[model samples]
Target chain A: MTMTDTNRQWRLKRFVQPDEILGEEHYELSESPMPTIDDEQILVKTLLLGTSPAQRMYVTEERTFHIAVEIGEVMSGRGVGVVMESKHPDFEAGEIIQATLGWQDYVALTPDDKSDTGKNVRTVQKVPNPVRPLTTIMGLFGQLAFSAYVGIIEVGQVKEGDVVLVSSAAGGVGSVACQLARIQGASKVVGIAGGQEKCDWLVEQGLCDSAIDYKKPGQDLAAAIGEHCPDGADVYLDNVGGAMLDAALQNIAVGARVVICGMISTEYMNPRPDGPKHYFNLLYKRSRMEGFFVFDYVPRWPEFEEQLREWYSQGKLKLVDDVFDGLPSAPRALGSLFTGGHTGGCVIRVADDPENIPAI
Target chain B: MTMTDTNRQWRLKRFVQPDEILGEEHYELSESPMPTIDDEQILVKTLLLGTSPAQRMYVTEERTFHIAVEIGEVMSGRGVGVVMESKHPDFEAGEIIQATLGWQDYVALTPDDKSDTGKNVRTVQKVPNPVRPLTTIMGLFGQLAFSAYVGIIEVGQVKEGDVVLVSSAAGGVGSVACQLARIQGASKVVGIAGGQEKCDWLVEQGLCDSAIDYKKPGQDLAAAIGEHCPDGADVYLDNVGGAMLDAALQNIAVGARVVICGMISTEYMNPRPDGPKHYFNLLYKRSRMEGFFVFDYVPRWPEFEEQLREWYSQGKLKLVDDVFDGLPSAPRALGSLFTGGHTGGCVIRVADDPENIPAI
Candidate 1:
């Protein structure tokens, strides 16, 4: 493959308003001469970019998140890339790896330099083996899956006979969490999603025993949850906070574990919404609610990857990606995370597999 | 001493309204023939009664609590009593004991008969080697102290060098929790109370390093907590929920443990108030919030009592009771818990120590 002389990129235009939908308007697309690698740097071409609800915080006007992107700087994101040229001994051309590739076609990375993203996973690292339809690497074996691992296995502690409930069930992390709960011997797995389609997709994919469509007309969330979980949820994995979290709290069983993985619904709202009205249940039921950042388990990522990869190879887990072709689709793809317009792992595919890489 | 043949009693007049204060009007005083002991039962005369904020839930019209008091039935409460007559081998006529004596002059108790009060501690048990002023048993070595122990030690996992915070800090359980945090090697302890007097009492009694008056006009609770706990609270024992819990949440350090012991602020309200608005901090700070019912620790009470007694004997702990004299003051004493009209462990003195009991 021949390398291009110019690189296309998207830069932050302004910070997002709390209630605003993140879209192309918040970013500007431009072209620049390809960047060159210095003595200890490597030139890498982006292959696929992952989208997360947390990305919106990086561009907020206030420093809401640890990692902030100033206006005019490249919009920050994580992605898989192929090393094109290496000035460092540790990396070689054609080596597949992952890092904070941002919203750009190519980047010059210093492997030993620490990332300011507040995420250790953003540090440049080599991908052991290349897999065909590389979305599998971004979906089943990437940061998204690690988040699911920590939230469901480590924090949620989903165990045998547990009745697990998951919010944002059709989203990337939620999808994996549902499956992990089942694999861990959950008696039942219930998923809550925004539309009938997503709900149907969840059950059809065997990701949940039952699915509750949150958008049902005049839906009474707490009542609906009670109907599905007559004995109450033994473990609740919350992705979309606000009302959904409150509803789950009302139906938790004794000694329930409520895992807070994300709060997409109210995270960006300037005046945040009220907390769960039924949090008092935590005391009534002798339960606990805990939150964690996947990055905090950086030292154990390898152990998590080993278990996840084993499950994938044994046909116990499957990769699900909603792929948007090309770098230009990045912003629109990210906006879909909050709009409920996409399912599975939302990702932007910037390029095809290199000639000699074997397809899985 | 002479035993009276007439018994004066207080019965429930009506269920309490959500927002109403518990007072004399809710109870009616009447006279009845003295209760008699059966073959396996014992008759006991009330000595002193202990009050807790949880009692309000027992009288709510909606059966909001596990143990409910029916209208016209004797009001439920726990107190210290002395046996007047015995029918079983384990007890003698002059033995002092603790049990659910209710709001009455005398009671017939079947020691082995299980209590339906949803509390094992309420079952009839001998007060070993009774101490004079017996208030010491209720304040420093009873259920109140047990609640504080579980919250700060077992649940909160407070360790040395930690900064601790307590709400309702001058109240029964809160007062004890502040001292436990110190004994556990906390570097600093801050207390939040309603009035300047209570605040001063907290620091003056050495229960807190500093105290915050939450009733200060136009006070921003979060700001006040931040000023006293500039580095953030590592362990927060919350007795009053609602807005106070929200304020504490805003000032928690990473990995902080917010123990929800009670939610007296909104517990009796028909329409409970919104939950803490800043609960999202549980995620932002990778923290945990847990709730526990003290009764769940019944099996371990003896263990807790042994340790608490050791501390009291070592002068590492002190008992503080806000006493109201006479059985006629029971209603008012219970009411003071909700009105913030009393500090320390609130208790009612029905009769003085028997002539033969030695003073401490």
Candidate 2:
């Protein structure tokens, strides 16, 4: 492949208002010279971009764990790329890697300054050779699957015979969570998803034993959960918060474990929305509710990778993605997460896989 | 004491509305023939009544974990008493015991039916010869202190140098939790109480390094928390859950432990009030918020008693109570919890301790 001078990026044009939906106007396609690599840097050619509600957070004016996306800067995001040129001793050309590469065609990961220590030190990690498709590496066997593993096994502690309930069940993290719960010997896996199609799709994949279509008119979600999980749920992996979480709270069994994975439902609501009114159920049922970030468990990724890779190879797990073609499709793909317009791992395919890329 | 036909009891005359304050109209002091003990029953003379906001719950029509108080029935409550008569093998006369004796001078404990298993089997426990005063046994060394022990030591897991923040800091559960957190090696303990007196009392006892009078005019609770817990709270033991919880939520450290011990603030609200609006902070800070009932930790009582008693002996822990005189004082004492009128353990001193009474 020949090196190109033109590098196109989806630059943040404005901060997203709390109540506003993301649009093309929020970000603009800007052309610039390709980023240069120093002796300690690696230039990466972006392939697939992962669209998550977390990406929307980067565009906000509020201070997050990392710096917010400023106007005229490439919108912060995560993507898997191939190393096109490298000066870093730890990286080489043609290697597949993953990092917070932003909404850009190329990412040059520079070395950390002397003051950078531990998590402050930024570096791209080489993607392991896949047992499944390379696209599955980013969706199921990679960051998406890694998040589910931490929530289900490490945080939720899903044990044998546990009845697992997942909100946003057909989405990126929830899909993997449902399968991971089943593989870990959950007696029943119940899923709550929007629309009849996603509900049917979840059960069709055998990811859930029962699925509740939350988008159905006049749906009493709490009653539906009771109908499916008569004994009440033992573990609830919550992604969509707001009213859905309140319904889940009512159906949790005594000593239930409610894992707070995400709150996409209320993320964009303006004047700080009301929280789960039934959170007192946490006391009444003697249950526990906890929130965690996947990065904290990064040091233990190899342990999760070993088990996940084995499960993928044994045909015990299914990996799927909702693909949006081309780089310009990023904005709509991300918005689909909040509106429940897409299922599985939402991926913006920036480019096709390189020829004869051998599986690990 | 001579047995008399005059069995004075406080019976629920009517259900107290959520917004209305408790009054004499809600309960009536009725006279009835003393309860007759059957062959498998024990008759007890009530002494001290432990009043709590939870007592207000019993009078409500809604069914909780336990049964609700019925009209014309003695109001459900917990108290210490002397066993006047016993026909059951497990009990005997003249022994001081504690049980859900209700707001009555005399109580007859009936044997459980064969089908009655688990928590349905009700029985009284003999009081140990406490190293502290007998009143203190029911307040600090009994259910109240046990709940605090489980929350602070077990759930919150207060470690050395941990900054502990407690809400309702002078109430039954909160008072003990504040002291217990300090005893567990917490470096800085900040308390949130309703008034200046309670705030001063919390700091005067040396239970907290700082105290925030939440009721003070123009006081910004979140800012006060920031001022006191400069490093952010490592463990937050929440009793009054509402806006105070929201304030504490905002100031939690990266890996803070939030122990939901009670939600007295919303227990009386008819429509069930909104919860902590800042609960999303759980996700941002990667913290764990868990609620627990003390009964679940009954198996670990001795573990708590050992530490509590040792601290009492060493004068490292101070146990205090707000005393109300006579039987008619029960309703008012319970109401005081909601109004934040009384601090420490709200105890209704029904009668004096009898001499030569052997403790079990």
Question: Each prediction's DockQ?
Answer: 0.85, 0.74
Q: Which residue ranges in model 1 land beyond 4 Å of their true spot? A: A115-118, A130-132, A355-360, B115-121, B355-360
Each model's TM-score, in the order given?
A: 0.97, 0.93
Tell me the tens digit of each residue's lDDT in model 2 across A186-273: 9999999988999999999899998999889987999999999999999999898888888999899989988888898888787888
Question: For each model in turn, which proportion of the native inter-chain contacts is also found?
Answer: 0.87, 0.71
lDDT of 1 by residue, B1-360 (tens): 467888888889988998899999999988889998888899989888889888888898888578788988888888888898999888888888988898888999999888555566557878888656688888987889999999999999999999999999999999999999999999999999999999999999999999999999999999999999998999999999999999999999999999999998888876878988999999999999999988888889879988988898899999888988888998999999888998899988877666545222
> What is the Å distance of residue B125 in model 2 from its true position?
1.3
TM-score, B chain, candidate 2?
Answer: 0.93
lDDT of residue B8 for candidate 2? 84
Candidate 2 C-alpha lDDT tens digits along B1-360: 667787789999998888877767899998888898788888988888887666677787675645478888888877888888999987778888877788888888864442322543144667767443567776777788998899999999999999999998888888888888888899988889988988998898787788999999998989989999988999999888888888999899988988888888887787988867888888888888889887677667667787788898898887778888888888888778888888788888776666633211
Q: What is the lDDT of residue A294 in candidate 1?
A: 84
TM-score of chain A of each: 0.97, 0.94
Overall lDDT per candidate, in order of appearance: 0.90, 0.82
Residue A324, model 1, lDDT: 90
lDDT of 2: 0.82
